[model samples]
Target: MQTPDQIWNDADLPTRRLAGLALNPSAPQDVLLRLLADGPLAVRMVLCRDRILPDAVVDAVIEHPDTYTRSFFARNPHVDPAQRARLIDDPEWFVRAHLAEGPRMPSPARPKPLPDEAIVHMISTYEDENMGSLGFYQQISTGLRRSLHTHPVAKVRCWGVGRWSGLSADARAALLADPDADVRERAQRHERYEDPACMERELPARPCHGRTDILLNRALSRAVVDGVLTAPAREDERATIAANPSLPTDVVVLLAADPDPEVRRRIASRADLGPDERRGLAVDPDPKVRLAVSVHPELSEKERAAIDYEVPMDCGFTFRHAPEVPPAPEAVRRDALSAHPLLRRKAAGDHSLPPDLVARLAADEDLGVRVLLAQNHPHAPAPLLLRSFLEYTGRERAHLTTRPNFPTTGLAAFADHEDPEVRALVALDPETGPATVERLTRDPDPAVRAALARHPNLPPPRLAELLDDEELAHVAAANPAWDADTIRRLAAAPLDGRT
Candidate 1:
């Protein structure tokens, strides 16, 4: 029944600082391991889930007695997937479920898929305890997906029912006749969607996630497509089916000329467009439609270049999963050098771009291109990372600061900038002098004030002043500049969480 704040504060006010202490970059190994082993759950939560751990601590977490502790690492993005997969056979179901859910942040770049053997083994024998996370698991690799329908294990094969649209006819038939009754039952269920009568009977009458799922994904026979199109109410309803991929060629032709521009936009991205359909959609009245068609797989660079698409200067780009087979270098060069900015933006996403190409795109005129390069390229120069951080206001902006080569010393130059967020960057730079650090202590923005409060180089008097400022106490105490005696006392505090 103890409150989290009460538990933290009753141990002494400094115990409330333990969460911040766990993230202190200069916190030593012995201190981190102690926090891991004996700290309160809140402290351990920060320690295990947020940063890379040393070998000894990783070993401890791998065998941690706490189920939540093990699961925390299951979704930790900083740890390698191979290390995270060590929990696939965990004694607890929640841990395995967490591993199945993949990383919390899947964009910028998703982590590598879990090992194929671990994936196959988990699906074959593990009971998901009704979490249903197994079905929505995102760590699946393309190679594993291709092999799913033929995996030696029947449960793994049965699991492929969800991917029925991608399976070969022979594979589907083999599944339909498999010795395992469950496998046959699943395959039959998927096969039933192919029947127009069943599709009609099961269709949810109104808009809902399930109806949208069926419209966009489940098999739709021409009869149902025609019936829905004939009886349709909203243009979005038609738009949903326009993107179904299972839509008949007739439906594709029908929707391409439909009264709604959104429907046309949805149809434009489909890869199967006949050459004429592709060309017509390219010049569609809707600029969004033309933009969608510009990147269709069938368009050559020259063909895409002719579209009058307007690339949004500040619009953010979404990242696709790393393709199973990487794009060839020559093809990437083609896109990177293409006249169209969208193609160049698409090429900016290839993580393996050679250094000269990364440097070239880093300075590209487009906001999305520079941000994409900063987000994906490991070798993105410090200046690009800094400039992207300054210019970009996306949720991913802070992630830019953590990139390799994000400048540390030279950022003191930004101290007096008009924008407080830009000025806040100077607060964290190790090279910012004591004078600027002192000046920033009173910056109009509380975020700037708090940021400089945590700088280890903040003048000792100011650091002490902020420590007792209730709003800044926890952050100030977290600073690694504290002398040896203070750190030892904070580290050695009994964290049993008993009053």
Candidate 2:
């Protein structure tokens, strides 16, 4: 047999075709390049996954006649940034859409900023497809601002107004009155401009009323300065600034002394904080601040334990039992469980805990703790818990009934449960037996009776029996299987009788 490299370089069309069948990682790079463009789409697709495909060849395939071939390159993380940039404007919307929606394109070791023309084209084409293209939006916004007075496209100018509505009052007022009606309309409706003074207020000096407009304006300004906004910001803007991961190191460092507890909390949570900063915050005056820092995800278990040791009991317990970190061990877990019922409730819902830990807490004496465990436990045995609660009355049974997957077995067993809520749960269970439905039809709750009357599996005779129960009869009449005759009968049924 020919060596893999020799087979790839055979040059004879039949030999090259045969050689392409060999899936060797060491296949000649030149041969892979030729095959990437000229080979069948499948062969080219496979070649796209090869780490050996040079940047130039990848660039060439990006504009290949076949969209699937271009998509393969677009999805490849190794594809050079320059090539990826060019493909962002591929005439085929599918290819452009794929590029826009694909995983973050890895930037080069020494990446050059995308050109203004390319950035503008990407923003105009792909903004609707993926709003997270923040770099592209920033570039376009910057360019539009520089050329706003004479920008050719009103739509582009309008995009600038919508994008930069978070700017200062003078700047926002100018955009709101721009020549384009759409720009004016967007600015007028803009949530950012609703509060005139919120964005201009200096934080740590004074706090504003927590109005929607004030929050939105402050949040938007903070987001623009920080380069990106996390999906959720904290209640306090000072805390938001201190906790923001994307802020410059200098800016974060300067925020360390911010007087607000929330701001100090954010500083404690900073991933970039050096050992000294961590230590300093570990002993900070504020208990909340110390707790927030101790539970920072960046801190190792050892670091957290150390911080827990140095802190006071209330603060240490808060940090030790914080939802951010996993329960330290069985001993620590027991301590957290014993500290406060609320702490036990928090521990029960900590997603990072082992499933067995959560399962153990699922039967906690506190209904809230059990409810939290049931809700957050990934492996919660719903059937068993529901079954166990079959004999529970009042609020306890009501709580179980609200879970996402209602315990059908337990609920089915409670078909004759005296409480309307339990009987109601059984009536609504998709797995409810015909006998269970019959029992629920007599439930005192009109809602439960109505649910049973409309059940598709309900026997025709049983449904007819409900025709006398006004609310249930009305629900039964709406079922598609109920004929016009059935509806007519239900309409004439007496309102006072039970179904």
Candidate 3:
């Protein structure tokens, strides 16, 4: 809070002087002018970051001999359109790269749209593998998107082709006749794409031709003989009918004794089979039938836990296709108050658990158990959720803050907490008042600023102030407060302005 003169007169570390400069957002133009002219690169960078900068000071920074000094303005949204035009063509590729992404930066008013020519320039040079003027594409009008359908660059035309839903029938027809093979291929492919109704109609009628296809059809009306399918003239057809749960219970029991091992395998997968039948199938000579019984949805929890296939993770394979075993509701409710915290944690998600049990889990000593209660227990009391915020440290507090009914009436206490991470979570809470949000906007931490940058509750003026920060560009673009037209206007560069 020292006077600007004091900052200049008593400089110890340049960073200290810069810190002092940052404290005074409304520092006079003359002071900024001197800093831009005389300050070291770090001090000057900090000067550029201030929300307000005089025209002369901006010009001085732009005219500086060092590429980094000049380049810094390219990423800054406050740079006027005329200044941006000049910076966009700065000799440094780094400068243009920053400007290409500059549209994402916050602006009090929607930024003047980049001309179509500038967009083409950005497409040609500034794009990398990760981002390629994607926000620009999101903002442009449908007509502009269509115009790119025939753009000389294949990549641009390909991007245009991908917006299939937006194209007019006539335009699509023209694309089908396009000289480029890729354009024609995409257009032709889109032309042949069927609507849901058409796809349903085109599906082959019943009495399917292939043995495998016939067996899989759930709708085939075929007769069963003594619990064995007799309609299929073929052996595999009987196996498939045996697998169908629609078959009568007596028919399935008959199929269990069929000569074909495949018939028993099919029966092993049926949902209607009783426990005794499954136990018999579990010991079938065919390993596939035994494996199916082991993983069957009806298998008891203890039974499933005992049937260990190769523990896939221990075998060094990171990805494994395994059946999920959800604990039964009755079992989960029983375990909700168990001495084992892990079992209690697993049971916290059971919707059928008594309300009192849910409250107990919410107050569980383990942080993870409490988090599960917050996420899965809909009836968890407000006091328990608030206690989580007040008692827990780190991100656990943040987790409780996002829960559906977590109390926000008195959450102002955490608004100015020392931890930026905690403050960032508070910023995301929909119930946090605008006054608290506006105060957090001035928070020194960039992480907190980033979180506030797109918070729906943040007042527009405060939201717009964040536009000047390059680090917050993406979040600013995504703020829900912006109406569709406003987003379109702010995100896209227009074609009329040639520069």
Candidate 4:
């Protein structure tokens, strides 16, 4: 029953400091304003840069005596145009220079376009690459697209041949005769592909689902339903067809009796089932089918009350929360509590479960299960998270230390953990104080030092030291604290050279 502010106030100095820094810009406005007023200088500096802070916070930060503090508030997006114009003539040259950058200071650099050959490789080699989407391809200018058609690289020409709508007969012949196999293949594929939209509009009269052309037509007409039905159904395709919301009711009913349990499971999830079908599926032989029926939207509240179903917590229905009616029968809750370690672990992740269940799972015998409970459960005890960090080993311990909400009460102990991985995790944790991060900069493990270099809260002086490390330079180049000029210098430096 303790309030967030009370909990925050009771925490040790280190814990309170870390909690302040770890708060996202989106933290409730009242808490952020309180931290800005009473928190330590480091906490206040972080709040000054938060772009979403209310105008009141912005006004206060801009008036701070320290020029460096005022400079940060100047760059924040929350500053109004009037404040921005005032900063233009401020005594601090840094503030004025940054304000002069534009209405938006620290403007993000526009990405340089990829080289033509690189663009070709991106589209021709990877279908899943988002740049290869139809909308992006359509945006290319006709003149620039024509240049690609005749580009010196065969891959570029191959990509062009696939998309060029106005290819001449002679040009198609020449492409087919091209020595590159990719170019010839692309030309042939385009020649054969009639757009699916053509079939959707033109083939309305045809049996939609069964025909090969209907497979090409993504149109959701009656023809598509007939094709899905009349076509010799493949087992792999049946599950997808069963899940399609647009499928005719008769086809959905037919799929309910599908020999494949997965297809039947999919059918049970459909939203348009009748009362009889819901009742019939409620007693299905497959436990998964019955579970799906229990939670199906089509199952009425009246029907749900009438059924004598014993639904387990592991089912997707109640994975995140328990059901209201029947209130997760006592027997089901007991089974979840005593189930195999795996089920108990899953049950612990359900935030709506009683606090006692979460506590039990947190202390479970299996380290992996306990780790899951610690990382996932909202009510997972803080002492439990801290204990795992101290006693456990491997990635689980590392995971506990890196959690943004990881209790910082005993955080200092792990900052010097003999395990380099735990030290690295602590160094990376936003909640770890600057002193610990500074200590870890000299950590024996280079990887730990590298992680410290990536910490957003790293001071500029510490970051400059990280730049001197050849191995950490690439990672350090990505830090937002450095201005464009500094980044350019960093990028221009040889990869093998020290700062």
Candidate 5:
């Protein structure tokens, strides 16, 4: 068996392949445990912190000696939220802190609510000291947040007092009269909300997304509404305020015909829009306003289709990674079958659409519809995934290739393709010739060369050559053809070892 030292004249402590080995879907359970126990930071990250681990690997990672590894695992997004409880009692503060923050980017779907026991523990026992704005994401789940007031633990119920601005009037009164001294005290402390100057003082001198978010969250006093709506120079602020849930009836009527198209457009999104308001906005001169009102739930599919809404085909269109609020399943079903292409596009991104709908959207005429289906739906057919990958070159374009059904075995045929992006797919195929692998190592495109450098079939001599080539060394080190002894040599060596 060739050693890593034999693979390179002098290789820097190699980890690129170690990381790759950790990501191999076919890697055995023991291999994963070994990687978690002995792997470098980069290896541990991919193995324990990125992929969902089997039960054995999960236990090993939970008990791993390295604080850094354990801490990273605390926040691993791919695993069950219930599994996060394994560390709930872990002594490390930051580990508990990360658990408290929930998974990173935890969206595109509402994360399952943490089991009530975990929430009760976090809400009752912890200080809010380490929590930043995202720490407040605890309040984001409506059902869970609302239930906090009824919790058996008084300290847990105390956290609910902080949501006074968002509470139902009945909820506020209940908290104020609560048996728990702490909960009642906290509720009383929030009474400053009655003083409109408190809200006025908190408003920033300049408008920002944060200020806009604050405006949207709180019910503005009449004085605050007057100050906000009078900002003729601040059209954007006025536009954002137009959609505030707490906007009064008269203000709602006033903003419905505000001079700025964006203000009217915001008004169009309001659920409380009267019948006359919806009809008028449906014919607004700005295409954006009509587009906003087109999907109003009150409107029939036929009525929505009749609106002159434009489905964007602009070159710059990009998919939003995680829609903050996933459309209701019924809405997804409705849009999946809608006459309008825009409505179809909305359905295309919903992974929950049944197989029949997934298939229909996979063959959609709109390019955005097809690409979104490919990017979002796990069961998107191999052919559709391939077609969408080729036709679309926008943001997240590369994400399509990583789909589970993306064809890899036969992609060797594209070895000589014109596009370097397509040419790179050749390396992913298991059957690519050693000759093709060697040739692509010198290809014009660095991405193509880098990908091909990691193929198991790459000629060992050329693999050795790339180990010395700084540009490709990391990925070349990631090649999986090295024998067990060679891998052990690399693994046993320091993460920053010299060849």
Candidate 6:
């Protein structure tokens, strides 16, 4: 039972290889360093796979010549900004693509310019592939505008307009009327024409779409107050506002008070709206408008309480922030309890609600309301929570089991609960013993067996027992630890025979 560090320092290759398997954070730093340096390339590859490795170690292996080694660094969450920049230009396309697509890659300090040589090469070789790769069709088009106009290749110029319009109005207008049909078609498709007459010149001061739009428009009127309309014309102003989300606070305040309910609703939905705008919407005449404000993530509990009187039965907005709302005062809680069933259900979901209130709601006579409380209520005792779900029959049982955090404790008792969902949950529980998994391997439902087979805690012996079950065998084969011997044995076993 040598420790990982002891094994790492051992002179033998086998010991060094075994040390690579111990990747926990507590493994000695020198052990990791040794693995990074002198260990076999395969062992170094495994060490690089660990995301929690020290920064020094990660940096050292990031440039490792092995493609998989470099990829491991590219995908490592802890790879620093400097390493990301290096990987972005990696010779391997897969590594570069991985860096480009990974969310953890730090945004480049300066936009990487499409190099003249590369741009030329791309124009010569890949110009006809797709508009997407030329970097012009996507929103916030940049980097390709200049090259498209003056490239040595006309096809590249034509492809460029098909992808991006020049920033200069005159250049754009000329390109719009270019002889090439592809160029003209793309300009027309994205409405990038430079001529004012080609597009809608005037828009409403406050354009309202459907009912939802009207509420958003109203919220904007109240939130925006100054330079509320700053465009060349009022219509242009409205269009500009719609296009850009950076409207000034004064403008947002003015827009929040607009007569249109949709305008108000849109403003309420904006995460950028300030406290003043939110407070105003909370008291809006329209219940839907008030409901929008009530559920806003930034609205304080006091603001939420102030709008409680206007909660709408038809909308789920009030319940959206149930996880964040502070505990309502006793009087308010009682009022909420006495409200319509839907309102009671909404209140029960409030994570801040007193446990007693949730406990009381768990006992409500209406099964739907009780189920809602059980699923939404964050603090209900485990046993009571399980009992509440057990009471559901038919479709109700199916609905209850779909909740993401359905209780796992009483699952075995309900293994035979007529509903497949209940049995599926039981089989899926990681805590289910090998014996339970063995029993479930023969479950009448294929989904139940699949769930049991995939459980992380399924014993190797139990997994061996299912070698002959086709679906179960497939699941067992997919496990990372499934070795060549296991696969060969499973393949040779008779279809319905257990080992």
lDDT of model 3 at position 88: 55
For every candidate structure, what is the RMSD over all alpha carbons to the true structure, in angstroms? 4.5, 22.4, 17.5, 19.0, 6.3, 15.9
Best of the candidates, TM-score: 1
Better of 1 and 3 by TM-score: 1
Write one digit per residue (lDDT tens) for candidate 3, span 1-499.
Answer: 3333453445334233333343234345565565566655555554564345677777777777766566556545554545655665677776666566554442112344455666555565655541365544543434556588768876567667866666778777778888888778877655544232332333343445643443454333333232225344454667767765456677777777677888887887788877878877776777766656665657755765554322111111011111124557677675675554445655765645677788778777766566556645556678776665655554334545555677756555678778676677676577888888778777899878767766778888776655444455435544666554443333232222210
List, in order, the clash count of every candidate structure. Answer: 0, 0, 4, 4, 1, 44
Q: How does each model score on TM-score?
A: 0.79, 0.37, 0.36, 0.36, 0.73, 0.38
Candidate ranking under TM-score, highest first, comes to: 1, 5, 6, 2, 4, 3
Among all candidates shown, the one with the greatest lDDT: 1
lDDT tens digits, residue span 32-96, model 5: 78888776676776576666779888888888777667777776777887786688877888678
**Which lDDT values do the candidates have, in the order given?**
0.77, 0.54, 0.58, 0.56, 0.75, 0.52
Worst 10 residues of 1 by lDDT: 1-10
lDDT of 4 at 339: 32
Model 1, range 75-121, lDDT digits (tens) per residue?
78787777888888899887787788766763455656788888887
Q: lDDT per residue, candidate 2, 1-499, as tens digits?
A: 3332442344333222212221233344455555665564445554553333566676568657877777666555444445666787688877676565543332211122445565556655565655355444433334455555335566556666654534667767777777788777877656444433344343222343443334333443544444322332344555545554445565566667666667777777777877667777887788777776776546656666665433222211111112323466773475344534544656765646676666667666665566556545545567634643454443334444445555554456667767666567665566777777777777778778866765666777876555444345434533334554443333233333421
**Which runs of model 1 end up more than 4 angstroms from their true locations?**
1-12, 28-41, 52-126, 129-131, 134-136, 139-153, 160-174, 191-201, 233-235, 274-284, 294-308, 318-320, 328-331, 483-485, 492-499
* TM-score attained by model 4: 0.36
Give lDDT: candidate 2, residue 402: 47
Worst 10 residues of 3 by lDDT: 312-321
Cα lDDT, model 4, residue 174:
79
lDDT score, residue 137, model 4? Answer: 51
- Comparing 4 with 6 on TM-score, the higher-scoring candidate is 6
| Candidate 3 wrongly placed segments (more than 4 Å) | 1-12, 19-23, 49-52, 78-83, 103-117, 124-159, 178-499
lDDT of 1 at 96: 84
In model 2, which regions exceed 4 Å deviation?
Answer: 1-259, 280-291, 306-410, 416-422, 428-447, 456-462, 465-470, 479-499
